[model samples]
Target chain A: MLSCREVTLLLSESLEHPLKLRERMALKIHLAMCDGCHSFEKQMFSLRGVAKQYVNGLADELIKCEDELPPPPL
Target chain B: MKINLEKSTKTTSEFLHDGEVVEDLRRQMLKFATQQLGDFHLAEDAVQDALIGALKNVTSFGGRAALKTWVFAILKNKIADVLRSKQKTVNVSSLQGAGEEDENEDFMSLFDQKGGWNHDDRPSQWCDPEASLSQKDFWIVFEACLDHLPPKQARIFMMREFIELETDEICEAADITINLLFVTLYRARMRLRECMDMNWYQRSQNHAELS
Candidate 1:
């Protein structure tokens, strides 16, 4: 019975922490019936997926640089 | 002194000899530091200091976290230190601009009075979102989109997802309450999704049609 707005609000929180059993059930049921919330959920997933890959690649490039890391301090 | 020497020797022989990899680690740490500190010079200093700290306590690193994560943890502290030192004179208005009120407005704007998605603002399916990851220009556009986020939101989002910090740790590092952290992350994701839709996915679909 959760509204689409409420379901989307919980989306990021669900990624961060587990939703309570009732909240989880409500969200599942809402998403099943709500195309807007479903598309919203899929986009959120894809955004995180693409961002992680791109940022990790940047991190890897940083790690693969040719300049030497500074030596440890005395 | 003897133990210190022994630790240094072991750390060097085990991980330091790979000069290129170590350098890359430094660069990666530097990039993370820069994103946190928002200053090239300060980021360099923070990363250098973090490297020194990491090396000094190399033996203490039990490998519970990845090497990159360990170094970034040190860098986070270093960046926090720098921010603290600058806290007295640093401008606060820009950082505090949107506040909770704006976040409520953002939430409200997403839905109709009856709580459904506003028809005009509902999410659209991107064509082959996974395939966009392979395109060369995708990252360029993505980084630009990230840079477009509000400073605080971008920092918190990157800390949570890219740096992979725990929720409590992110709240502590950003000195924000848990509620504020969640709101900022929610907005960041929403904005990033919108940006990618218009700038990357939508454009690519049009390009495919023309070809």
Candidate 2:
């Protein structure tokens, strides 16, 4: 059985790379029994969601930074 | 000569327009595109397309920043279009060398001698995270948490999450091994997760009790 410490590393790696089959099975079994690891995994996902919003907000700020220049000389 | 906007953006600006203010703004737009697309020629092309698009749509491109920002928005799409087309060809990564970064990042404090989670550091289930997503203050707290990360860890986290770079791409770009990338990212995520829980989740609870 994978420890919570080991599972945390695998969980983060799982976001970046596909885990090997043995690693996957071990993580699954550990997660099924461990509440702490499960919640930690959920937090990782929520962090990704918030990151997207952060990037979108940043881009929107850039787009909204238009100045009130006088209308171009006609 | 390719305008060599590749390295000297100001020279490219000098080639196009003389207004110092407009050139400065053009420099800003060019910098943003280059950071996203990673090549000056492509960035210049995108910037040119954006400028032309803005001018054709609104002939009076005379505004101080109005015209430039509109061009920026268009430039973003152009950069994305370029990235989409170039994503496959961009994978010339070097799978070499073990990086020594993050060798000292031990997570032992959070685990007991038997490897179970420490009582104090064990993660608790978050409450109503979906609702928090729409709250502006939550994002403010999230940004503050990101700001609190160590410099190297912060850079890697941003590349992976915000810029959406692959782990292998990050390994190549940062000159680190796959294992080092995983360790660095794991530390970053742990810190960010803990920070959000403490700053946002628990702080909100305290506020709820106080009110």
Candidate 3:
């Protein structure tokens, strides 16, 4: 069984590249049983969703950059 | 190139009325251009050319595409032209693995001895995160997190997500290896997710409230 930490790594990596069959199987099985990792997987999708919207509204966004200069580090 | 100024339409009149919008767009364009060109004067020249080009053809902006999108397309072309003339040079010393050891440790700190999540720092469940997209305040906080991302990670993230470049292309553009790109992206995604949750969904008192 893969650790949740390892699973999270694979989960993020899956966005960038296709996982190996073994890695995919492990992640799928882990996600089925692990609620935390499941939530994480969904969050990844949400992140992409917001990112796409941000790009779609890029003009409005960049314009905001003008009203207030980039904010200080959080 | 000879577009008759006489062919102006209602869109042009409305667009011209919003002089403030054009001014805001110019400032934003300059910011983006300065980041890419690394020279204020050069970036100003490029943005000026693009804006002039855009206004000259403002009539062509008839309801087909967004006004900002139209102006940005011209700006992109002008920036590309300048880049071709000046050549690509990105000073990413921060990205060249200067503090990778610290970064690895920071990420690993989220997990435990057996690789389980830490009790205090486990990922929080974000409810109906998609719905946040429709809220105007959401963009404000989200942009805060984006600006807060570590500079190195921010660069790669922007290259991939904002600039919309592929992994291999990013590696070549940043003059980094594939391994480095993957690690950087992983860190960027993880941190960004956590930051958004903390600042928006979690809404801790100390963090900026999404008003």
Best by DockQ: 3
1 versus 2: better lDDT goes to: 1
Off by over 4 Å in 1: A58-74, B1-29, B39-42, B49-107, B129-134, B204-211
Stretches off by above 4 angstroms in model 3 are: A58-74, B1-18, B33-65, B73-95, B98-104, B128-134, B204-211
Q: Please provide, for model 1 over B145-196, each residue's C-alpha lDDT reduced to its tens digit, 9 standing for 90 to 100.
A: 8888877788778767765677786665556778887778888888887777
Q: Against the true structure, what is model 1's DockQ?
A: 0.26
In order, what DockQ does each candidate have?
0.26, 0.27, 0.27
Candidate 1 residue pairs in clash (backbone atoms < 3 Å)? A63-B24, A63-B25
> lDDT rank, highest first?
3, 1, 2
Residue B75, candidate 3: alpha-carbon lDDT: 70
Compose the digit string of candidate 1's lDDT tens values, residues A1-74.
78787887799888788889999999899888888888888877777766555443323321111121111110
State residue B204's C-alpha deviation in candidate 1, in Å: 5.3
Interface RMSD of 3: 8.0
TM-score of chain B of 1: 0.58
The sequence of per-residue lDDT tens digits that candidate 3 reaches over residues B1-211 is 8877775454743674477867777887787667554568877988889878876776735542366666666776675555444334444453466236336545777889889888877665675333323355566777778767766677677666655566776676566788777778788888888878777667644546532
Comparing candidate 2 with candidate 3, which one achieves the higher DockQ? 3
A-chain TM-score, model 2: 0.73
The DockQ-based order of candidates, best leading, equals 3, 2, 1
> What residue runs in model 2 are displaced by over 4 Å at the alpha carbon?
A57-74, B1-103, B129-134, B204-211
lDDT of 1: 0.65
Tell how far residue B112 is off in model 1, in angstroms: 2.0
Q: Which ten residues in a row have the lowest lDDT in candidate 3 chain B?
A: B128-137
Task: Compute the DockQ of candidate 3.
Answer: 0.27
